[model samples]
Each structure stands twice: as C-alpha cells, then as structure tokens.
Target chain A: MTASRKPVPKPTPDTQPFWDGTAAGELRVQRCAACSRHCFYPRPSCPACGSGELEWITASGRATLYSYVINHRPAPGFEDDGPYAIAVVELEEGVRMMTNIVGVEITPENLELDMPLQVVFEKRGDMHLPLFEPTGAGL
Target chain B: MKDAVVIAGAAESDELGKLPHLSTLQLQLGSARNAMADAGLTKDDIDGVACVGSPIQIAHSLGITPAWLDGTGVGGSSFLFHVRHATAAIRAGLCHTVLITHGESGRSRVGAARMAMGPDSVLGQFELPYGVLGPTTTFTIPALRYMKETGLTHEQLAEVAVAQRRWANLNPRAAMRDLITVDDVFASRMVAYPFHLLECCLVTDGGGALIVTSEDRARALGTAKPLVHVLGTGESADAPIISQMEDFTSSKGFRLSSAAAFAEAGISHDDVDHVMIYDAFAHVPIYGLEDMGFLKRGEAGAFIAEGHTSPGGRLPLNTNGGGLSYTHTGMYGMFAIQEAVRQLRGEAAAQVPGAEISVVLGNGGMFASAATLVLAGHRG
Candidate 1:
C-alpha cells in the first residue's frame, strides 16, 4: 500500500524557492553569478562553474518537446491514468526537465518533436507540481 | 600491453530463470564457488573481492579474507567497472587474484530489500512527482528521441527483438528460446510507446562471478578454461538521473567509456569479432552500437533491421540472446561479460566461428553510467 501512494517533492533550502515560485504561478530557475549560465532542479551552487553564488530568476515559462512517450503501463498511484504522456521539455533557458504533457490527447500522432509548450501548475498536497501543455491549444 | 589481466575463471549460479530456494547472497556464494572451482583455485588464492551486491556478505559467507575490496554499485555495468579496477589493482600490486560477483533475484525477489524511489532522492524529487517509477517509463524519453532523430519506425525496433531471438534460438540456456518474429514483437503488449513486451529484457533470478588475475599467475595455475585476456577496459560515471543526460538521442557515458576502452586496446571497430551490447530494452543496443562507435549516427536501427549483427552476419551480437532473450537478473552486465569471454574462448553455444576479440559494453542506472571492456583470445 505504501508503494501506491503518490510521490511528493521534499524541498531543501536550496530548492525551496523554485517550489514557492510554482505555487505563485511562476517558473523559477537558477543562474550562476560567476558563469552566467542557468540550471534546473535547483541547487545551492552552479554545476557549470562550481560557484556558490547562484541567483534565482523566473523562467520564461516557455519550452519545447525534447522527447516523450505515452506510458501504457501506469505506476501504482497512476493506475487510473493509463497511456499518459511523460515528456522531457527543453526550456528556453537552456535546461531540460521531465514533466507530463497535458491539455491535449496523449498519443504519438498528437506529440511531435520540437512542439512548443507552456508551463502549468497542479497542486499535490502542499507541493505545486509543474506540468506542461501545448502552446496555444485552445482559442 | 600495459599489463596482462585475464579472466582466469567465470560461471553462472547453480540455475537461472527461477530459483525460489536461494537468496541473492546464496546465489553470489554459489557463483563464487563455481568460478573458483573452474579457475582451480581456493579461497586462500583470492586476495581481492569486488561485487555490486554485498561484497562484505560474499567475503564473509565464502570465508574469503581479501586484502583489497571494491563495492562499486553503479548499476548492471558495475562488474565491468570492477574488471577495470581489478586490472589496475593487479598491476599496482594491490592484490593478486580478484573475485567480482553479481547476484540478483529479479524474478523471485527473495531476500531482496525493497527499493523505494524515496521522496528524498534526487530522481524522486524532480521526476517521481510526474508518475515515473521504473526504467520502462524513464527510458521512454530517450527511446522516443532516438526514434525522432533517426526517423526510425516501430517495425524497425521490432526487428531488433526478432534478430536477437534468432540468436536465442541457438542457446538452450536462454530463457525464451522460442523463435520470435517481427510480427510477434509488434503483436506483444506495449509497455510504452514503441516498446513492446518482447522488446524488453526477461525478468529472471540468477547470478554470475568472475576471477581476474595477472597473466603470469593464470598461466602458472594452468586451468583448463581458455585464457580470455583483458586487452582494454573503460568506465564513465555521468549524470545520476535520466533527465540530466547530455542529449536524449545518445548516451555520453557510453561514448566516453567505449572510446577509452578502444584507445587502451589499440584496435579499430573492424578488429572486433563479437559484441554484447546490453539489451535491457531494444533501444539500448541501438544506442550502444552508435555510441560505442561500431556504427555511425542513425544507423544501428537500420543495420539491426538488416540483420548485420545476427547469427551468420558479419558481426554476431548478443549470442547469448542478450538481456532480451537471455536472463536479466536486474543487473545484466556480468552476463554480457560472461558471454564475451565464452565467445573469445570458442566455447559459446551460439559461437561465432574463430572469434578472436569480443567487445562488451554495459549501461547502468538510467543511462547515467557506462563501462566497456575489450577481451581478446590471446594477447594482441
């Protein structure tokens, strides 16, 4: 039964800001002060330059479908949601993150490489999980 | 050659596919005894111990007092890394004979500790929230990316499974030796988009062990088993998570490890007589072939579809049926190495005629780590 429970994010001081931003309807990321590069899965220091002076910045909320698959075999917690799109989107800020693609049909024909996407937030308990939707899906 | 380190002995546990009577520790000990018996050595001869699963338990249970120990648990490929490190340890005089073992009850799950992708782990924090739990889900991203970039089709992926089954048909020890067709692969249930059930590795309970020692010692011992020399070895630890890979279409760790091994071996792709690319899934070999420099970009899927690597082809890949048709005890690396040694020794059931050199490449974690080894029948 423990495996059936949905997983939630546990935030540390280094990653708290990104979670807070998600709750506030913004996509937050880190930029290295020394190297002028961006990173995701927020950390205390820069991965590229190893500098401890990383500053938080709001992302453009823009991304593109790097790649994805419609998982027919759902995990225990996601038993009702079969054949859903598990996607990795490359953001405009030069980093990629794994997320689910929603607000459209989850099929190979509907999902294409380099398709534009936008960020959306879904609340799971106290955590606001970030998901993506196709750009301009509806009028 | 820098220093000659050969596989003095190698073996599988008492039985594979399913062993309800044994725990993972028992499997390791069983394999250790078999390998030591095959090598004509005793516990006193083993001065080093290395394993991906419970090195301490193996040493204690087997009554081995090793002066050197390596417990590198990278993934399936950890054994290849063990070989790499054992080679160095032998040359450095840190140990005389090294024993590397692998044991996993992937099917029976007996005495196997429950592994939860906890909320505190990095993957659990970033990707688990999205309902990604196993390799079947996480690996889908890269498989899709490869398909898009190479214009590969679903049928092409099925061809990989079909060809591997052809090789499996010749292997009696193979778990699913019944011949499969591309149609059969397509007909199988889909776990993820483009990945059919047949395309995935067999979940089985088994284990294997290997003994590495200086060439002088091996020759001195004079075991009847063929001497498979370790001509080259390489390992690379890349990102810890799948989402952090340098690119979705290729594995940087595979490239780095293969390149290092090839450079150390001082051989070209043409010199390889046999290969075992870890086929935990169909796409894995496609990545392994291209990333290991055996094929160019966007060519493995088609090359495989054309049967270039199957039996009677110019190159024989996964002669043991690979993890696809062969037994995959969670970590499939040791099995690949065992096959390469068999091919090099001219002792394999699905043997490649006059095989001189065999290249074994293994991927660990979720495309996060890799280790490669080039084995030769004789010192090259």
Candidate 2:
C-alpha cells in the first residue's frame, strides 16, 4: 500500500445510523414507510415515491454480482495489490450498490455475472467498508 | 423554434494534443477569441455568455458584459446542454448572441480545478471508499453486464475502436491516424477489465467555443462564415452514482434526451445524414445507438462491426475522429458540437458529401446526464 492514507467515509446526519449498523456487524438500508420499498446508500427521501418517512432495517446481506471492472490501476491504499475488482451487486431486496470484491482472484474466469455473493465488512481507517465475497456455507 | 437559432461561429483551441505551457484560463480565452473572430465579430458584439465555469470571468476577460449567463457544468456533456439552452434563450429574446466556451488542461493539470467530493457526499460515502478510480474504472463497470445480457463478445467490443480509427485516418488533425484492427486493440494495454487502453478516450489539453445567434441577426450581419441551423435540442439527468442507475443494460438519460431532441427537430431517423455519439468509451456509442432508437437492443454490436458507422458508410459517425482518436480535454461535448457544425458547413477535414443534417449525442458523468442536438446546414 502507498504511504498516502485511504479515504474514509464520514457519515452524515442522515447516514450515521446506517454506518452504526455496519460497525455492529450488520448491513442496513432504508425502507420507505410510504412506498413500502427498500433503498440503499441511505437517503432522506424515497426515490420511488419521494416520501420523507423512512425506517432502517437490517439486510439479508445476500447479493449477486451485477457488474464490475478489474481495475489495473489501483487507487491509494491499493497500490500494493496488483489488480482489484470493483463491483456492483444487486441485493436480495433489489437495490444495487458499489463495493470491492474480496476472497477471490480478480479475473474474468473467477468472477462471472450473476454469481452468488454475500457482504462482509472490512476495517478501513475509521470506517467499516462493506465488501463482497463469493457465497460460502453460513454466509 | 425550428431553425430560429443558428451557429455563426465554432472553433477549437489553437492546438489540442498537449500544451503544458498553457493554463486553463488561457485555453478558454484562446478558443473564445478564435470563435468570435470566425464569426467576424468583436467583443462588443457578444452580449451574452455561457460555459461550464463562471461566465462572468470569461466575459470580463474579453472586456464584455451581457444580460444573459449560464453556468450549467454537468460534466463533459455540459456544452450540448448549453447549445440547447442558448437556443431557448435566443428564441425567448433573453439574449441576442450567446457564446459557450470549454477549456481544460486535462493532461497537463495546469490551473485546473482539483477533483473533490465531500466525505458525506453520496459518491464519497458509498463508492469512493471502495477504491473506485475515476472514469477509467467506474465508467467501464457496466460493460460486462451489458455484454453478458446482450451476447456482445469481447471482439465485437474492440470493433468500436477499429471503426473510429478508420474515420480518424482520413482526418489530418486527428491524434491517432494509423489503421488498427481488433487484434491491435486487444494487444493494447489494459486499463480496466473489458476496456483496453485503445477503447478509452484520450486525456489531452484543449478547448473549444461556439457562437449562437438568431437567423435574422445572421442575415443582418451578412457574415461570410457558413451558418449551421439549430434544428433541435434536449437535455436530461439520471442517478448521480453509477450503481444507482435505473438499468444496467441501458441509459435512462440517453433514451429520454435523444427522444426529446428528435421530437423537437420534427425529423425521422431517415432524415439524419451524419452522426456523432460521444465515445468517452467504446461501449458508450453502443448504449447510445440502442437508447436513441436508431437500432434495437442486442443489434448495435453487429451494426457497428459491419461498418455502418465507418467512413464511406451510409451513416458516417465521428468524422473528426471523436474523443477516442481526436482531442478530448475533459469536457468533450464542445468538440462534438464543433464537428457537427463543420460537417453541416461542408468544412470538416473528412467532409461527408451531400450531408444536410447531422446529429450529436453527448454523455456526462458515467451516464449520469445526457444532451442531444440536431443540426442542419440550411433552414429546414
């Protein structure tokens, strides 16, 4: 890794609870009370219905790889790593998110679209980043 | 408002590829001056200004002030939105003549604004912490999913570069002119998975500017430069982050923006004589071709690989080499607009014969926004 520090996510007043869930070993997303729909990357208003009434809920942590690119050029804190996979995964609740794929060799042969995966948190600076890995027993 | 606004002046910076000596402000002023000169006008003639950055600074630098100003900086496609906005402003009598300028030292990093995002911002909180780089990584994320669902092979993806190179070879100002095959593209350095270095756009230092005025004003001035009529314009936005996009296989912004432009132009797909889809990456045009209603899904791959968009083809595309082979200084929409005007005026280096109408499609911020323009040589 480069001597430069990695960027850390500073939670906002709206997103602090979501970050709190991650620190407690849970993946949390918002469910719009008005529309009864789930949303990721937690926000104040529902995208589907535009309602301000939202509730936090612990997610199943199950997802499938929707798409990704194996970046040959690593950002800071990934300099030591040769090439890494940055992915977007579709959750069981139908919302999609951006995350790093861990626990597998970064290659097209190893990573296929729609492959089963589960979220796992990794400590980065002061934040717990939710990274994904191939599904295994008890995941 | 059909043919009510005409492009009286358009020009790129004095030089495009690399200018380490030039600052961002210099690039902007240089191109702005060249465009005004091309229109046979002085600083006094320009009563309005528009650009991605502050219009006041540009106006003050040129010793001119105006009643109209637009600072719609929505990534590389901002210039297309400016063209569309200027058309509306001119027809509404809010501005007589509008000048849009774009300048960036992308490669040189000379006096360019630093890339910054708040830690609590949507992208900063969710995407950036995961080691997501700039466009090279994020913009390319959707290709694998698109390929899998549509059966678009890797070789076919490389064909996008090969086709544009053919057009680049015919233009002297193009940065990359040599003919390249699919094999050559694969042999090129890999920047991101499913995206070779050849498939990504160039990061060069350059700028471009445009001058839009009413048709009556052009007639009154009787300028010698050819006038390219603004037949239609449209603009729209989608999810800010790439992962939050409505659909992975297509772009909502592209579909909506292009449809509005076509509707306003009152022309069928058959009327378009030439095309320029902003190719920030090779897959972008594929998304554009299908989203813009030119072809059905799962068919654009074959259409491009078959040489339909190449030089001498029925629907010639990116005749000025595009951002891929030509100069792409950060915001590339201005360059795309410049090419359409050139083609319509029959003044392009790789001129298209009998071309009366041309369409330009632009994408901004990883499909986050889009704008489309339909232009013609004469009043239609």
Model 2 over residues B268-364: C-alpha lDDT tens digits?
Answer: 9999999999999999989998998999998888889999999888888888888899878988989999999999989999999988999999999
- After aligning candidate 1 to the native by TM-score, how far in Å is the CA of B35 from where it should be? 0.6
Q: Which 10 successive residues of model 2 chain B have the least lDDT summed? A: B1-10
Model 2 over residues A17-124: C-alpha lDDT tens digits? 989988998999999999889998788899899999999988899999999999998887888777999899999988999998998888989998999999999887
How far in Å is the alpha carbon of B266 misplaced in model 1? 0.8
| lDDT of candidate 1 over B1-380, digit per residue (tens) | 46789999999887999888899888888888999998889988899999985677888888899889999989889999999999999999999999998888889999886768677678877988888858888865788888878888888888889999999899989999999888899899988887889988889999999999989999887866888899999999678888888888889989999999999999999999999998889989998999999888899989998999889999899999999998899899999999998888888999999999999999898888999999999998
**Which model scores highest in DockQ?**
2
Q: For residue B178, give model 2's deviation from the true position in Å.
A: 0.8
- Which stretches of model 2 miss by more than 4 angstroms? A1-4, A137-139, B1-3
Question: Per-residue CA lDDT of candidate 1, range A1-139, in tens?
Answer: 5334668888877778988999999999999999999998778889998999999999998999998778888876777776888888999999999999988988888998899999988887788888999998743
